[model samples]
Target: MYECAVLSVYVDLALGLAVTFLLLSLLVSGLNEAFVRLLSIRSKFLWAYLRDTLDGADDRTGAWLPAGVLDVFRVLPFLRDPRPRHSDRPAPAQPSAVPDPGERAGDSMINLLYERVREIDHGKRGRTSISDIPPARFAVAVMELVTAGGDVDDFLTRLRQIDSPLYGPLKGVWESAQRDLDRFTKGVETWFDGEMQRLSTLYKRYVTWVVAVLGVVVTLLFSMDGLEYAKTLLRDNAYRASVTAVAEAGPEAYAELRARCAGQEPVACVTETLSQPALVGMLDQALVSLSIPDQGAPSVHWNGGRWWDRVTTPAHWPGFLLTYVALLFGAPFWWDVLRRITGIKAKR
Candidate 1:
């Protein structure tokens, strides 16, 4: 019986952590959406990479790709060039008859790159390369925009000077571009694909940082202390009973919410789950258990209005930091932990 009592305390701690993590995830996602709207941070990375790829090359030839090629990469959101739409380039005329050999020679290197790939006999069943289609077509189109006005080097230099994350790890590729344009173009394609993979990891890092900062702010705002709250729940049988009841009912609600929010992109899914009124009400009920006057609200700040004293207390620092760091582990993690605990409780 004593062992069960101690175990219940641990379960309550996990439940608290799960609730906080969900809140943190929503905060981070909201911040990301705001950043995207304000700065176009996501698209800027692609543009900077494109600039770096075209760095240092001058187009002495007056050749340009057909205006239709500009639309080649429109299907890909990441590769889409945002600069050209805002640039002062004059509108191009529609494609007429095919140009003679000399006129085609003056086309952009990127234009030729696409042409080379198109000339390949796919009947040989050769594996697709970045230059092959879709990606290659998109790359060439964006490259034309990045290198427009023969200012590839200047464009990337400006992006680098601005110190954006979009200029990530492309110094070597740009340096190589100075020596061999073909190799530079290929490296750019490779780097773009590689960066696409890295983008996922980078986004998580941003969210982790956002969650940590937001966790600290929230803890300060609510005067939350993980350790003190745990102790309070353990000492008060009524409070623990209320929490247990809520937790016991959480599994089915969570499962239903999960099913409803499944198949969405990460940001959208988290936003949807966090916004659900049913889930929000469940969390509110659990919080009520912690703050009810008869239950002797776990933290004194709940009853006493000494917000500064609660915020400045040294003993709460460790618990505050613990919550902040746990937030970095993210909501899905705590949700799974709570789910396992609930499963064990169900069996018993």
Candidate 2:
């Protein structure tokens, strides 16, 4: 009977910890999403990939393609500024002398292909740039641009005229296609898919650092001392039981919150979910139960003491680090773990 009682306590403690981590994970994820959107990180990476692929150089200097090609690409009809120009402002004067079309045919062709691939939608709010383009659409756009209102023969001839680093690979794709337009389009699609896969890998690597920073910030802000919290859960029967009860009902609560937050922006969704009376009450109880003296202060505080002692709280560092690392695993992962733990508890 004593062993069974101890097992029950341990299970309840695990449930409480799982619930805490799950909630923290959700907050971190929503904040991270909002930050990513605000900074346009995905859009920037997409632009960098496009620039590197089209110009054969990631930098603005343009190793194979001419400088300013990416700038011109950004100004294409489908990609130009989205904000409406003020009607009161005078229109810019057009130059009388036109430059030779041959001078910028390569740049123009690249821009045309991009414009076709990602045509602007009239219904949605206008966006200056896009974060993604379908590989199949990109392939079709390339074929259409090279054909130039002519047949497959024109596409073949124009393909040869491509003066950039893309010429050699495109030629290989052409040969693999046996000069068939459909086969050529499929080859291009495959090529673009491979490049996009690489881009996705690079984006994940970059986002990892961003997530780490956000995790540290969140850990410090909440004073989440994982070790201290665990110790409290082990010692305090009433608190553990209360938190475990909440954890047992967590799935239904999460489902309701998810339904309430559907279609909302990440920041707004987090705000709305956290503002729920039940959630607020739970968090209040948790704050008191956890014995966190200053509700809003970070782990490191300016206590009224000597300058060195005031800001030095090395004791919380290990727990803070552990919490930060856990947060970096992301919300979906914690949610899955929470579900599994809940299932385990049910089985017992």
**What's the distance in Å from true for residue 186, model 1?**
9.3
* Structural similarity to truth (TM-score) of each candidate: 0.45, 0.64
Give candidate 1's whole-model lDDT: 0.47
How many steric clashes does model 2 contain?
0
lDDT of each: 0.47, 0.57
Best by TM-score: 2
In model 1, which regions exceed 4 Å deviation? 1-6, 55-137, 140-191, 198-208, 238-305, 344-348
Off by over 4 Å in 2: 58-102, 105-110, 120-127, 149-162, 238-311, 344-348
- Predicted structure 2: lDDT: 0.57
Tens digits of lDDT, candidate 1, 1-348:
879976866776666556656675556557656754444444443433333333322244211111232322232223333221221223232212222334433222323233333333231122212222334544454355446434456545544554423344445676877746666667767776775665446444544554566666655655566666555444444443544554578765445434544655534665443444332322332222232233454542232345566667898888667656666666667667767766734335
